[model samples]
Target: MKAVYIAKHGGPEVLTYGDRPNPEVAPGEIMLRVRASALNRLDLNLRDGKNYRGALPRVMGCDIAGEVVTISPNAHTDLKVGDRVILDNRTKCGVCESCRMGLDQNCTNGKRLGVDLDGGHAEYVTAPAANAHKFPQTMSFTEAAALPIVAHTAWHCLITQAQIRPWDDVLIQAAGSGVGSMGIQIAKMMGCRVITTAGSDWKLLKAKELGAYEGINYRTTPDLSKRVLELTGGKGVDVVFDCVGADVWEHNLKSLKPGGRLVITGVTSGTKASMDLSLLQGRPLHLMGSGGRSRRTFADMMKMVRQGSLHGVVDRVFPLDSVAEAHKVLESREYFGKLVVES
Candidate 1:
């Protein structure tokens, strides 16, 4: 099997594309022929040894869509050979305290596929049978590959955490990002008026096509909160779904209505920020962080996907051998939605 693995962390140059041993199906696990894998900022962080530390020679992809080729005989699953599916990268120990309490997202014994285990960047990969979910027949492998991380994150943040209402005015930061784009779609599906931000005009246009009611070019708009207030008739948004932290922290706080909710999932920008203590007491705002997503919420997201109300947005596709180039594009942040690599 040929895989893209990193033995050392530094840059895209550390990604080694070469032959590796094919993974064997372990108990309670299924081995799949990789069809497509999507890139995330986590991949870049892992590749560059930023914040994350892991073992060497780790395969580098978390968002996977593939066909089951082999299932361990002891695996208690209905999945069969040739079934197409997308995977939930997080694996939780079923007997953990949190899992026994039906809070698997908070399980103490949790391992991520692309981070803590070998992921689906190769010709084949193995994952727990419970993590695999069948995608709709109408969906392509590339589209399915794009859904796992971004869709799950956005769904968990907006629906489960923020509890977004249809009448709410929502603001989504970084419209060009995978989670940001998915957030716009999810918020719009709930009938919320969505205002989104991007670095460029074309990206803003793309965001509007995905259902954002208004788009702000943050590169030009020095005062993001002012524009958001203007868009909302000066009341500010009812909910803010932010992925870029620190850089937008103050603006996100100011752009919210009194008692509004703000859910943050990522901090691609620097993480440190100073918040006015007075604002917290005065507005009594609700601040939430998107922790690990639950299997229940993943199911909720898949239900929408199956209903055709939600779809993965694919910005570009690259071949398996061109993973380095794909990583470059991901780092450049020049594309909207997901950048996929086909096996």
Candidate 2:
């Protein structure tokens, strides 16, 4: 099987495409003839020598949609050969405290596909039955491939952690990002009023097209929080999704009403964020940390995709052998949604 791997961690140039042994299916696992995969910032991080610190020849892809070509004889009701499925990025040790509570991402012994093991960048890959879900036949593999990561992230932060409700205004910082695009759609599906900030005019327009009720251009807006307050008629937002952590934290915090929720998943915009402790105490804000979605969330989200209420916006496509290019695009932040890799 031919797949892409990080020959060394430095740049996209480190990505190598070549043949490797076909993965052997283990009991309680299924071999998928992967048709398409999507690139996330995590993939780029690994390529650029960030969080992923592993041995050489690391397979770097997490989001995948594929057909089950073979199934091990575990006889689990959740899986069978010939069923179309999407890979779940998170896996857990069922014995862990978090896993026992169905919070797999928070599991003490959690593992991520692609980072800790081989992922779906090749013609075929094997994954635990519990980590892959049968997808709707009506959708394309490219679209299904886009669901696992961002959709799960959105579900985790907004649905599971924030407990968002209808008519609530939510602020999504960096609405042009791959996760931001997913967040916008997710918030809208939940019946929340979505507001987002983008770095470019094109990105802002793209966010509006994806159901954001209001789009603010961050590049030009000097007083983002003030504008957000005005947009909500001085009420502020109920929740603020801060993916661009340091750059948007203070601004987003100022935009939130007293007792408002602030959910953060990533610090994509550097590591430091300055906050006013006085305002935090006076407002009694609910600052929360959210990341790593569960299997249940991924499964329920796929149901929404199958029903046509949620859509995966694909920004670009590259052949499985061209993963280096995929990493480049993600790092450039030129994409409005996902960068797909076809197997």
Question: Which candidate gets the maximum lDDT versus the true structure?
Answer: 1
Q: Tell me how far the alpha carbon of residue 48 in candidate 2 is from the true structure, in angstroms, after superposition.
A: 2.8
User: Which one wins on TM-score?
Assistant: 1
Clash count for each candidate, listed in order shown = 0, 0
| Global fold similarity of model 1 (TM-score) | 0.99
For residues 21-72, write the lDDT of model 2, one tens digit per residue: 8999887788899999888887777777777677767777888889988878
Candidate 1, residues 220-293, lDDT tens digits: the string is: 99799999999999999999999999999999999999999999999989789999988889988999999989
TM-score of each: 0.99, 0.96
By summed lDDT, the worst window of 10 consecutive residues in model 1 runs over 48-57
Worst window of 10 by summed lDDT in candidate 2 = 72-81
Q: Supply candidate 1's per-residue lDDT for 221.
A: 94
